[model samples]
Target: MKKKVAKFSVLPVVGASIFFYSFSTNKAQDINTALLEEFKTVNEELTFEVPYSPDAAVFDPQLRSYPALGKSYVAFKEALGFKESGGDYKVINEFGYMGKYQFGRGTLKLIGIRDTNLFLNSPDLQEAAFYANASRNKWILRKDIERFEDQVVNGIKITESGILAAAHLAGPGNVKKFLRSNGTNSFSDGFGTSIKHYFKKFEGFDTSFVVPDRKAKANSPSVI
Candidate 1:
């Protein structure tokens, strides 16, 4: 009886096993490194990307720029008159509000203008009437103007011009009410224009020149 022993090199088998293990580990590391590099490349691409607005239309300069109020009193009043009645000197609304500045007969009389047709037809007179009314409103609301100017009310800044403009829209009484009520008492005219809308629209214009005169007349030489 003969016993046979299997003769195989354990070193070769172990060496081959170790070699393959190291090779596979290095291959996996290279793969991970490649994947990481790819990920970093994608991230870098995203880093330079900017979020876009759905409505990114460019704003119009004509619409955004404030009218040149600092140029002249006529320019300022003309700009306001345009908003009031499209600068139409002969315009009289259904509410009996006459001319570009939209003055009622009572208001025109208060400013001492007896002739209705003259106020309506003459642009200069209409502009003068606006100055008179502005002065009157300014005088009436002087304390309120001094107290509320540069203060924020209901998320809108209260300017002197804003107050005067609101007064123009809803009269000094309603403007006072709206101011005292912290803008909760919104007043709209016969034409559906709101006091707050006027306040916002007329903000940031220089109205310091509008002096408070109790007897502000349309023909007043200082009415500017």
Candidate 2:
């Protein structure tokens, strides 16, 4: 009898090929993943812009993306003035705070306004004062705004505009204390308005465009 010749079958070869393909694909993926992880960890201190959390975005959706202190910002502040003193530039609160934005004497001076009457009587002056004060406050709390914006503190989500508004309502010093204390150090104006109230009322507007300037003046052309 002739010796049986071995049958050549493709099945064993095909099985080995498939196994090698799968193993190669998995190994490639593992290598890519490791490279990506390394790239991300390359610089631990690298920072990036992040979206505001839902609760932190307190402005009306339409107002959320408005440029800082832009047209809509002007309108919002006008409405705020309306709420505060009926948009009456001449109205002085019982506490002696005057004008559309209800500024105090010290705050006016800080913004380079020496005449309370001019600050309250001139619409241009009032507008400039509002913008100047907002800028000054934004400067004072710049770091806090960066760190706390989009974060929840004392169950209230923080926003840049909200922080500025709070600083306006309470002094920047008070706002700092309140934020650092995580809402424990509550403050109310002589009018009895709380910092939290300002935070809530002024939430979700963009104040990031406001530059921090120690020399921010109400008479500055940019503010006016």
- Identify the leading candidate in terms of TM-score: 1
Q: What are the lDDT figures for the candidates, one per model?
A: 0.82, 0.80
**lDDT per residue (tens digit) for residues 1-224 in model 2:** 13332234556677899999999999999999999898888755585779776666356666545445543566557656876788889988888888888888888888888877566668988888888888888888889998898888898888888888888788899989988999899899876889998887788876655778877898743332
Q: Tens-digit lDDT track for model 1 on 1-224?
A: 12322235566778899999999999999999999999999998888756786987788767766555563445556667888899788988898888888888888788888788666667777777888899999999999998899999888899888888888878899988888889888888876888888889878777777888989899833232
lDDT of model 2, residue 109: 80
Query: Every model's Cα RMSD, please?
Result: 15.5, 22.7
Query: What residue pairs are clashing in model 1?
Result: none
Alpha-carbon TM-score of each model against the true structure? 0.65, 0.64
Clashes of 1: 0
